[model samples]
Every structure is written in structure tokens, then in C-alpha cells.
Target: MSVLLVLPIVLPLLAAALAIIAYNHRTLQRIVAVGALIAVVADSVFLLLAVERDGVQSVQMGGWPAPLGITLVVDMFSALMLVISMVTVLSVLIYAIGQPGVDQDQPVFHPVYLVMTAGVALSFTTGDLFNLFVAYEITLAASYVLITLGGRREQIRSGMTYIIINLLASTLFVVGIAWVYAATGTVNMADLAVKIAQLPSGTQTALSMFLLVVFGIKAAIFPLFFWLPDSYPTARMPVTAVFAGLLTKVGVYSIIRTQTLLFPQHRPSTILLVCAGLTMVIGVLGAIAQNDMKRILSFHIVSQIGYMILGLGLFSVAGVAGTVFFIFHQIPVKTALFLATGLVEQSTGSTALSKVGGMIRRTPLVAALFLLAALSLAGIPPLSGFVGKLGIIQAGLSAGEYAIIGVSLVVSLLTLFSMIKIWNGVFLGTAEDPTLRLAASEGETRLATPLLMRGATVALVGVTLAIALFAGTLFDLSERAAQGLLDPSAYIEKVLG
Candidate 1:
């Protein structure tokens, strides 16, 4: 089981090297990329089951003991995140494969994507603060490449902003890590948990706030989220979808891990709650103002992140459980929406609502996929999003957080309205051009979306429905994860003993 812990990170790195070596062989790159991601998914699932059955797993990198060596830890939370991240990457990779432009830029896309996958896996499992920073850098480096792959003016401009902001955030992260190590004499997370508790309250609070700011930037919390909408919408669809689905969640996960383990007794719940409310309100307002599908979804990412933070702010078992479940639900649903939008762009040469109308008449299946994913995102009933949102709201109510509850309800309504806006703008209105009445008709050469792309989008939609179907078991796993977070003694004992 401990050996399985390293496979997820190692496999992708090795695959990335292979991909670069076979850069000219596009077919081989595809096989290597998809095969590696599939292996990661399998490994992640096995780790999840193993953690559930036997408890938290840890591996020492060079066989040195903890507090002196690098460690990879896989509790329920980490394992669950790993599984979902891999699944999302795999789905997006399939979609990317069906895009010829992506293959035309094969040398850059394949290897960098694998490196990004590895980075995401490492970020979830690493037990040392420095390694977490390294994971983030690796992920961001790959993202810089992926986002600016074609060197289009908009992509390059947006990628520059993305790079500058993240570099600043990374600098802060390193400074914070250095400060922690200076204070504690150890960078190992579990060990730091014990040492941090011994520090003065003021010192601890300062450190906590510093790290929060670092991750808040990455997670795209209210004030720190300005870079996301601008940067995300300029990327190609597969790149945007992967970033939307996985990257911000990594930041949220880090916040959960650090807040739970290192500062359990001194959570900044009030601050987080305030930020959550503001993020929800501001993000949705931006979404409502957008006339483009990608921009709307990108802003919604900021809005949805607030729900997870809201759950975390509640600081209860149910709150953490809901946050975890919501992260899981949002990843697939959001990715599916982006993939559907990508299909729209490929078929209609635009994602602008004004340019791409009447998709319901031309491509009903794509419309259906987008509608299902949009409704799920808006927390419509019987979908995964609804289950996750209900849990969070109930938890907030239980905690007597009436203000946040009211805010959440308002946000959900706004989310639904934003979804409807996209629906009406993209699918409901009459086609802007009369000759483009039917999809793939001789007059509509540009409106032919590949079957493979549509299939991949449909597969992600199925994942969202499956989450709803298995909500009971998934929520139970999330609850157990939350319980572990609320009480980190078991994790500490395993990692530092």
C-alpha cells in the first residue's frame, strides 16, 4: 500500500519523459499519456480503498525517518482527491486527443500535460511543506506552457498575467514555508502540527494568516481571484477545463490540510466566511455580465469555490464532509460544462453567446450535455451538486450560521440564473445565420464537431450523474475524511511515529 502511494506521482513523471522522447510520434504520445493517466486512476482508487480499510498510509522517500526525509502521505482526503484529479485529467486528455490543433502542437502539449498531472498528484500526497511548494511550481510551469501553447495574442497575454501572479504567490509560499521551518525546525506537515501548537498564539496566527493568503491566491478566493477569469477563458478548451477542474481545488485542499492539521485550534473561520460570501456574490455577478460561454463558466468557478470555503469555514464534521463532497462533485460537472462549450466552439467557431445560438436545434446532444452539467452546477435536484450543496447548507444551519446560509441560498439562485442565461444565449435563440440551420450541413462546414469530442463530453456528464447515484457511499467516504481532518492525531501518529 505504501508502495502504491508513490506510483501515482512516479508513473506520470516517467510517462512525461517518454512522451518527450517520442515527441514526433503523436500516436505514441497519445498512448503514453492516456495509458499513464489510466494507471494513475487505478492506483488512486486502490489507495483510496486501502486507506479506508487499513488507515492513513505514508512512505519515506529515501528510507530515512520522518522530520528528516521527504514523505508522501495518503489519508482518505488525499486519496479521494487523487482519484478525482486523475479521472478529470483522463477525460480531458481524451478530448484533447480529438483536437487536431492539439496534436499539431504535440511536442509541447503531451509532455507538459503529463508533468502537470504528476504535479497535481504530488501536491495532494506530499507531507513536507517544501515538497508541496515544489509540486505547485511543477504544476504551474506546465500550466504556463499549456495556456500559451499556440502563442496567440490573447493566450500569451493572459498567460503572462497568470505567470506573474502565480510567481508572486509562489514567492509568498516559499517565504511562508521558510518561516515555518525556522520556527519549528521541521518541514514535515505532521511534525509541524505538533510544533506549531507549542508556538505562541500570536506567532501561530501570523503563520496561519500568511499561508492562507498564499493558498487563497491559488484557490482564487474573492479578492485574490481576479486573475482566473481573464487567464482561464483565453486558453484552449481542454486546457481551460483541466485548470478549472483541478488547480484551484488543489489550493482548497491545501487550505483544508493546513488549517486542519497545523492550526486546528485557531481557525480564521470568520475571515474565511466573509471571504466566502464576497467571493460568491462577486463571482456570480461577473458571470451574469459575461456574454461568452467560457468566461461565464470561468467566473462560476470562483463562485463555486466559495461553497467549499464556506463549508470549511463552518469547521464541523458535516462542514468538512460537505466541502469534500462538493469538491468532488464540482470537478466533473465543471469539466463537463467546459467540454460541452469546447464542442460548441469547435462546431460554431465561437463560444460567444451572441455568435453561437440555436445549438439546441443543430446539436441537441451537445445542448443536452451542457444543460445537464449547467443544472448540476446550479445545484438542481437529484444531481451531485444539489446533494453537496444541501449538505453544506444543512451544516451551516446546524452551526447556526444564518448569514452564510442566506448568502448561499442567494448564490444558488444566481447560479441558476447564470446557467439559464447561457442556455438562452447559446442554445435557445435563433441561429444568427439562416443557412446554418442544421449542424454539419454542406453550408455549415465549420459546424462539424467530432464524434470523439462529443463522446468525451458525454462521458464526463455520466460521471456527474454517477456521483449523484452513489452519493450515499461517496458522502460517507467524505464524512470519514472530514472526521480524520477534524482530528489529525491518527495522521500525525502514522507520519511521525
Candidate 2:
């Protein structure tokens, strides 16, 4: 059982190595990616069941014991994140294969993607603070390469800014780790949680706040989010889709983890609550200002990040549980919307609302998928997004944070307007160029939408619908995750035993 804990990270590393050697063979790359994705999905199922049946599972590395070795712990929270991350990456990988302009002959993209998967998995599983930092760098490095893959001018420019910002954040992370280690004399997360209480209050406050800012940078909090919109829109479609889906959330996850594990204090709570309110307001306004599909979605990512932080700020069982559920719901919906937008770009040659029109008539299936995801983003009923938002809002109101609640309400309403804005311009309005529409109708020159791409969209839409339909079970699972996080001795024991 413990051996199974390593498979998610190991499998991807192995697959990436094999794919690197088979770079010249597109078919081989495809097979490797599919195989890796299947293994990840299978691992996700096994982890979920293990947590369900046996409670949280932990594995200490190299036969060492707690506080002395690297540990991989799989609680309900980690397992669910693993599953959601797998689903998003797998779908994006499939969609990437279907993308029109991706050069499969270059092994760099697929291998880097696998490495990124491993990084996310490791970040979720690791019990050591330094190991988490290492995992983050591994993922960040891979993403940097992926962002700059095409060498387009915009990609290069955006990628440079992305690298600089992340590098600065990484430096801060290292400094925080050093400070934590100096104070606690150990780098293990579970150990730090225990020793943290014994530290001097000033030391604890400084270290914890420093760590929060570090994670906040990655999470794209209101003031720390300037790099997101500029950098996100410059990546290739699949790259942007996957990044939109998972990367920033890694930061959010870290914030939740650190707050719950090491700094469950009023100071962190107060700061996070204020940050959440501001993030919502700032992100939505950014969205309102964008006319491009990808850019708008990119800003909304920051907006939604606020919701997740709102849960963390409340520091209650319902709050954490709701946040966990929201993160899970957001991953697929965000990626699916990005993929739909990519398809629109593929067929219409632009993601600008002005350049894209009549998508509902031109590509009905893709348009439907986009609308479903957008509605989900807006927290509409009968979707997973609504369930998650309801939980968060209820938690917020119940906690008597009415101002935050009001802000959350405003953000949601503005989010709806932004969604409707895209919906009207791209799918409802007339195509600005009649000749382009005429060219679109001519079968001889019509852009061929691949079956894999369509299948991916259908599959993601199914996930969104299923999550909505089975929201009760999902929320319960998140509740269990929240409980596990609140009392992480089980995680520490498993990893360190």
C-alpha cells in the first residue's frame, strides 16, 4: 500500500524519460502520454479508495522514519486533488494532440508536460517543506519551457516575465524555508506543525506571514497578480489551458496547507479575508476590461482564486471543505472553457470577441461546451460551480462576514456579466466578415475539427455535469478531506512511521 504512494510521481517520471527518447516518433509520444495518463487515473482511483477505506495513507522514503526522511502522505484532500489534477491534465493532453499546429515531432512539449504532472502530484503528496519547494521548481521549470515552446515573440516576452516573477517567488520560498528550519530545526512539514507552537511569537508571525506572501505570489493574490494576465494569454492554447487549470491552484493549495498545518492563527485569518475581498473586486474588473476570450478567462482565474482564499480565511470546517470542493470544480471547468476557446481560435483564427461570432451556429457542440463551462464559472444552478459557491457563501454568511459575502455576491454578478459579454460577442452576434463566414461554409476549405478534440470536450462536459449531479457525494468527500487536514497527525504518522 505504501508502495502505491510513489507510483503517481514515479510513473510520470518514467514515462517522460521514455518519451524523451522517442521524441522523433509522434506515435510513440502519443502512446507514452496515453499510457501515463491511464496510470495516473488508475492511481487516483486507488488513492481515493485507500483513503476511503483505510483512512489517510503515508509513505516515508528510503526506509527512514518521521522527521528524518522525505514523506508522501495521501489524505482525502491530497487524493481528491490528485484525481482532479489527473483528469484535467489527461483531458488537456488529449486536446493537445488534437490541436492543429502542435508539432509532435518535438519531444520537448510532451515530456515537459509529464514532468509538470509529476511536480503537481509531488507537491500534493510531500510531507517535507523543502521537498515541496523542490517539486514546485520542477513544475515551474517545465512550465517555463512549455510556455516558450513555439518561440513566438509574445510567448518569449511573456515567458521571460513569468520566469522572473517565479524565480523571485522561489527565492522567497527558500528564504522562508531557511527561516522555518532555523526556528524549528527541521524542514519536515508535519514536524514543523508540531514545533511551530513552541517558537517565539514574533518568529512565528514573521515566518508565517513571509510564507503566506510566497504562496500568495504563486496563487496570484490581488496585488501579487500582475504577472498572470500578461503571461497567461501569451502561451499556446494547450499550454494556457493546462496552466489556467492547475498551476496557480498549486499556490492556493500550498496556502491552505501552510495555514492549516503551521499557522492556524487569527492574524493569518484576518489578512486572508481582506485579501480575498480585494482579489474578487480586482479580478472581476480586470475581466470586464478584456475582450479576448483567453485574457478574460485569465483574469477570472484570479477572481476565482479569491473564492478559494475566502474559504481558507474562514478557517472553519465548512470553509475548508467548501474550498476543497471549489478547487476541484474549478479545474475542469476552467480547462474545458479554455479548450473550447482554443477550438474557436482554431476554426476562426482568433479568440477576440470581435473576430469570433456565430459560434453557436458555426460550431454548435463547441459552443455548448463553452456555455456550460461559463455558466458553471458564473455559479449557476445545476452545476458543480454552484454547489461549491453555495457552500462558500453559506459559510461566509454563517460566520457573519457579511461584507465579504456582499463582495462575493458582487463578484459573482460581475462574473455573470463577463460571461454574458463573451457569450454575446462570440456566439450570439453576427460574424463581422461575411467572406470569412462564406469561407467557413465552403466544405472544400472548412477547418477540420478533430474527433479527439470533440471527444475531449464531451468528456469534460460530462465531468462537469456529473460533478453537479453528484455534488452531495463530492461535498462529503471534501468534508472528509477537511477533517483530515484539520487533524494531520494521521498524515504525519503515516508518513513518518
Candidate 3:
């Protein structure tokens, strides 16, 4: 049974090799990629259920002892993250397949994308700090290929910024790992949790703050997040959609994992609260300023991350559970929004607010999809976003965190305003030119979005609604996960034993 723990990481990698071998046949490559993701999604659901049934599940690679051999672990949090992330990427892959033309190395796209998937799986499941770094590198390396896949001038420009920034973060991650190992005598997270508590209070605090910055940069939090809005908008819509949906969330997952486990202060963290406030305000403001559909969505990705950090700052089970639920909401909603924008670009030919309009008449289904996702993103009632924001706000109020909660409310309003800007500019108003000459087909008739693209977007939207409709069950799961995160003795024992 424990052997199944490795499948999440191994399946994509095995498929990636197969994808490379099938370069001569695009049909076979597509089959390989899609089939592997389906297996992963099924496996992820199994893992989540198993973790729920069985408590924390962990194993040592090559049968080595704890704190000596490689470890891979799955708790409620990891399992949930795995499930959501896999579902999101699967949607993005389907969306990518349906994109009829532009220019991308289709053969290489399959392998590189699967490698990124494996890296993301590793990030969620690895039990040690060093391997986590390895996971990040693997993900980043694949991303470097993906962001630049088409070799466009814009893609290359943004891809360079993305690469240089992540490389620096990767360097700092290594340094932080070195410091942790030198201080704690083990890189395994469960062991580090035990030993880190034994260190000098001063040392613990310093290490905590230092690693926060390292992962913060990766997570695109606050001042460190400047690279993201600029970087994400330039990639192919599918690439941007997947990156928006899953990659930064991986960083958030890292922060939640390491901070709760390694630090475990069990109270409000002033530093995290401050960072959250700043990230929320700044990111929304950036979104408001953007005239492009992709940029606006990209900026909101930064803003929404603040809420997750806000939940973490409260350092309570309720707060973290809210954070967990929010992560679930963000993964699909954000991906859906980006994809809707991609659809807009496809139909009208440009994402710039000044150039495109009246898409509601042209592509009503896509327009409806965009509005549903937009409203969800803005925390409207009865949607998944509303529930996530409410969970965090209630947690904050309970923790007497009124100031940050107020900031969050303001940010929510601002977020709604920016989303409205997109709706007005892209869907509601008249196009700057009715001819729609910018569309790929080169006539007044806009490009017809593929059935697969529409189907994939619909699937994601359905996921969001399902999350909202089943909020109670998901909240129960997130609360359980948060409880495990709060008191990780169960996690530590499962790993170290």
C-alpha cells in the first residue's frame, strides 16, 4: 500500500519518457499525457480518502530509516493539495490540446509539461527540505521550457525575468536548507520539527524569518511578488492559466507546510499579518491599473494569495482551515478566470481592454463562464469564493485580528471593482472595432473556440460550483487537515517511525 505513495511522482515522469518516444505521433503523445493525468487525478482522490481513513501516510525510500533515508509523506493537507492541483493541471492540459494554432513545440510540450507535473507532485509529497528544493528546481526548470515554448519575443522577455528571479530564490532555498541542516542535524521535516524546537529561541526566530523570505519569494508574497504579474501575462494562455492556477499555490503550500511544522508558534504572527496586508492591497491596486485581461487576472493572483497568508498569520486551526478551503477555491477559480480571458483573446484577438468588447454577444457561453468565475473571484454569495473569504474573516475576527480583517474587506471590494473593469471592457461594451480583424481567422467573424476548450473551461467552473455546493463537507475536510497541521505529532510520528 505504501508503494502507492510513489505513483504520484513516478507516473508523470514515466509518461514524460513515453511522450518523448512518441514524438513522431502527436495522437499517441496526447493519449499518453491525458491518460497519465487521469490516473493521477484518480490516484490523488484515493490518497485523500486514504489519508482521511488512515491518518497520516508516510514511507522511507529504499527502506532507509527515518532521518537517514529519503522520506515521502502525505497528510490531509498534502493529499488535498495533490488532489486539487492535479485536477487543475488536467484541465489546463485539455485546454492546451484544444488550442488549434499559434506556435508551440507540441512534441516537447508533452514531456516538459509532465516533468512539471511530477515536480509539482514531488513538492506536495516530499518529506524533507532538500527534496522539496529538488522539487522546486524540477518544477522551475520545466517552467523555463514552458514559458518560452513558443519562442515569442514577449514570452522570452517575461521568461527571462521569471527564470532569473526563481534561480535566485533557488539559491536562497539551498542556503536556507544548509542552515537548517547545520543547526538541526537533519533535513527531514519531521526531524527538523523535533530538533528546531530544541534550538535557541533567537536562532529559531532568525531561521524562521529567513526561510519565510525564501519561500515567500517562491510563493510570490508581497514585495517579493513583483516578478509575477509581469511574467505570467506573456506566456501562452494555457501556460499562463496553469501557472496562475497551480505554480504560485505550490509556493503557498510550501509556506503553510514549513511554517506550521517547523515553527509551530500557535499564535498570531505579526510578520505574516503585515505581509498579508501589503500583498492584498498592492496586488489589487495593480489589477485596477491593468488594461489587459491577462494582466488584471495575473495581478489578482497576487492579491488572492494574501488571503491565504492572512489565514496562516492567525496561526489557528480555524484560520489555517479557512486557508486550506481558500486554496481549494483559488486553484480552480483562478484557472477558470485566466482561461476565460484566453477565450476572450482567442475570439477577439487581443486582451487589451481598449481593443476588445461586446464579447457577450459573440460568445455568450464563454461570456457566461467568465462572469461566473469573475463573480466567484470577487467573493459573491453562494459561490465558493464567498465561502472561502467568509471562513478566513470569521477566523480572523475570532482571533481579534480586526485591522487585517478590515484590510481584507477593502481588498475584496477593490478586487470586485477590478473584475468589473474586465467585464465592462471585454464583455459588455462595444468593441473598439466591430470588424474583429485581430482575430486569427482575419475577418469580421471571430474565431470559433474549440469544443474541447469550452468543455475544459466548463469542467473547471463546475469544480468551483461543486466546491461551493459541498462547502460543508470540504470545510470539514479542511478543518481536519488544519487540526493535523496545528498539532503535527501525528505527522511527525508517522514520518519518523
Candidate 4:
């Protein structure tokens, strides 16, 4: 259990070290990344199986007890998130190695990516509030570097906005932590949960609201989402994919964790509900207005986050479960689509809908993969997105939130329309150059060539189809994870005992 808890964080940290040491060697960096990804996948699988069979478990570092030493809790929810996160990282790693923008031998890129991965793993598993803060900082610092990796005028300008916004959010996070700790004497989440409700209602509410704003910024819900669209698109392809995949979801995870565990009876559902509705409406509108593929996807990320939070705001088991399920669906689909967009940009030298054209006539396989991913994003039937959206709508209707249901439905439709716009513009239009040929067939393939960037387009297309086909099994897993999160006393006792 301890091994499972630690391996996800440790694997990436060790890989980052190796990457730094092998800074000038592209092959070594790729080997380290692949090896670390394999270990992460294995660890996540082992932990997932262990939790399913034996229930929630926790491990205290250095063999010390909790409250005094750090602890990593592997509840069904955390374990499931761990698995999804690792899978996203592995996919993005393959995509990164394939993208021409990435300097695999760049001294800092691989190492920073590994650090970000480790930070995300730690953030999901940590049992203490201060530790969570530190984990978040680790992720943020790594991301700041990643957002500027290209160092282009646009990337830097966007990176500055990202850095400023996140730094402020981090400061607020610290302030909230101080208040929570001052109010309750300990920073262990389980302990805080037990103690928090005992505080005066006003105090509890204040703390809850404070944390909400802190995480709300991270989650990009409502007005707090302004930083996302401006910043995300400027990064390189794989960097954008990885950032799109994990960062906002981590924010949502924190919102879910803190709400369910520490403030189970906190009555901010109305506030959250209103925010979620607004977020979806505004985000999708932003997406519709964008011509850039990356910008459109970034806005959609904000919009989709609203759906997840709406599930959380409903404060029902099914709603929370639906959020979890959708989160699982969204991570891979979003990143894969972004990765596919990267390919389009790579081929056409642009991500703007106006600039990208005739992908089907040129790179048919890439076009197919993008279609699968985009259709899934639009929540089409028989795809994983449909399963997730159905759950949320079911939860909303059951709770009698017709307005939410209506808005969500409208959002879904508009989302489909927006996706189609991209499809028509980028895939179906006349070829941009009318002379561009496939990169792989034009040149010789080598042993070290990145597959997904080159011939692996077909393979990625297959993987996306597989995810769409296996929606049932994944939905069930997410349901179980949500149930575990809603009743975390079992998790608390197992970890602290």
C-alpha cells in the first residue's frame, strides 16, 4: 500500500533527475520518459486493484504516524484519479516525443515535465492540507516553466498572464490554509473534517468560501477562467495537451475533495450552482467566438468544468459520481484532441481554422482521429462523452434542477455545433498548400522517430476509438470512485489508524 502511494510521485521525480543528467541526449530522455510512464501505469493499476479488492488504504512516509508526518491516502477516488492522470501523461509523452516543437534534448523541458507529473500525482494522493499546498506549488512552478518553454513572443506574453494569475491564486490558497489551520489546530484533511463542522457556522462558511475562491481560480469556473484561454494556446502542442489534461482537473479534484471531506454540510450549493451555470454559458460562447483551435479548446475546457462542478454542487451521490465519470472522459478526450490539433498545426503551420484546411485530403488518418475525439467531446451517442453527459443530465433532472438541465443541454448542442465548425473548416475545406505531402513517406523513418508524431497517427486514432467503445466499464469504475469520495470516513480511519 505504501509502495502504491509513493511510486507515482517517486517515479516521475527520479525520471526528472535522469532527464537532467542526460540533458544533451535525446534518446536517453525518451528512454527515461517511457520507463517512468510504464512505472506510473503499473503503480496506478496496482493501487486501483488493491483499493477495489481491499478498500481504501493509506501510507505514512518515513514509517512515522499521521498528523506528525506526511501521509498518502489511496482511496478509490484518489487511486482512480492517479490512474487517469498517469494514462494522460503517458499519452502526452508519446505525443511530445513526436512533436517537432519539442526539443527532447533541451535541458529543462523533460525534467520540468517530469516534475509537473510528480506534482500532480502528489496533489491527488496527499492527506494533509499544507502538503497539498506544497504539491500545488510544485505543479504551478513546473507549469510556469512549461508555458514558456517555447519562449516565443506570444508564449511569453501568455505565460506572464498565467504566472501572475496563478501566483495570486497561490497566495490566496496560503491565506485560506492559514485561516483553516488557525481555526482548527491541524492541517490533516481528515482531522480538519472532523474539527471543522464543530466550529461556529459563520467561521466554517467563511473558510469554505475562501477555499472555494482559491480552488475556483484553479478550476477556472466563472470569472476566474479569464486566464485560461489567453495562456493555454500559446504553449507547444504536447505542453498544451498535458496542461489541458491535468491542471484544471486537479483544481476540480480539490474542490470535490474539500467539499465532500471537510465541509460535507457546507450549504454553498446555491452559490456553486449559479456559478456553474454561468461558467458553462460564458465558456462555450467564448469557444464559439474563437477561430484558433487551441483557443477554442481552452474555452471549452472552462465550459466543461462547469458541468463537473454542477454535478458537485447538486450535493448528491449520483451527481458527484457523474462529475467523476465525466472527468475521466474529459481528460483523455481533451488532450487527444489537442494533440491532434497540434498535428494539424504542425502540418499546416497554423492552428487557426482559417489557416487549416483539407486535412482529410492530406492526412486522412489524422483527420479521422480528430473527428473521433471531437465527436466524443460533443457528447455524441455511443461515445464516452455521451455516457458522461447522460449521467450529469440524469443527476440534474432527478434533483429537479430544470434550469441547469436546460442550460447544460443547450451547452451540449452548442458544443456540438462548435466542434462541427472546426470539422468543416479544418478537415473538409480545400487543401491549404495543395502541395504538402505526408512527412513520413517523404523521408526515411529511423529507429528513434516518434510514432504518434509520424506514423502513429493511426495508432492514436485506434486508441480514441477504443475509449469510445469501452465507455461502459469506465463509467462503472467512476461510479465506484464517486461513492468512495462521498463516504470518506472509511478512508480517514484507514489512513490514521
lDDT of 2 at 15: 93
* Model 3, residue 419: C-alpha shift (Å): 0.5
TM agreement with the true structure for every prediction: 0.98, 0.98, 0.97, 0.95
Q: Which stretches of candidate 2 lie over 4 Å from their true place?
A: 265-267, 443-445
Worst 10 residues of 2 by lDDT: 439-448
Q: lDDT score of model 3?
A: 0.91
Residue-pair clash count for candidate 2: 0
Q: Write the per-residue lDDT of candidate 2 for residues 1-497, one digit (tens) a residue.
A: 98678988999999999988987787888889889888888988899998899997888889798788888888899899999889889998998898766745456888899999999999988888999999999999999999898899988999999999999999999999988988889998888888898887888888888998999999999789999999999888888999999999999999888888886542477889999999999999999999999999999999999999999898888988999999999999998999888888888778888877888987888889999999999999988899999999999989999999899999999999999999999999787877767767775334567788888877887898989998999999999999887777776666555
Write one digit per residue (lDDT tens) for candidate 1, span 1-497: 67799999899999999999997988898899899999999999999999989999999999999999999999999988999889989999999998758767557698899999999999999999899999999999999999998889999999999999999999999899999989999899999999999999999999999999999999999899999999999998999999999999999999999999999879899999999999999999999999899999999999999999999999999999999999999998999999999998888777877766778998899999999999999999899999999999999999999998999999999999999999998899876754444544664757778777888898999999999999999999999999999999999999998
Candidate 3 on 1-497: residue-level lDDT in tens?
A: 68668988999999999988887678788899899999999999999999999999998999998899889999999998999999999999999999876224457898999999999999999999999999999999999998988889988998899999999999999999999989988999999999999899888888988888988997899999999999999988888999999999999999999988998753339989999999999999999999899999999999999999999899889999999999999999999998888888877778999888878887899999999999999999899999999999999999999999999999999999999998998888887865563553365445688888889999999999999999999999999999999899999999888
Model 4 RMSD in angstroms: 2.7
Off by over 4 Å in 3: 102-104, 266-268, 434-445
Candidate 1: C-alpha RMSD after superposition = 1.3
RMSD (Å) per prediction: 1.3, 1.3, 1.6, 2.7
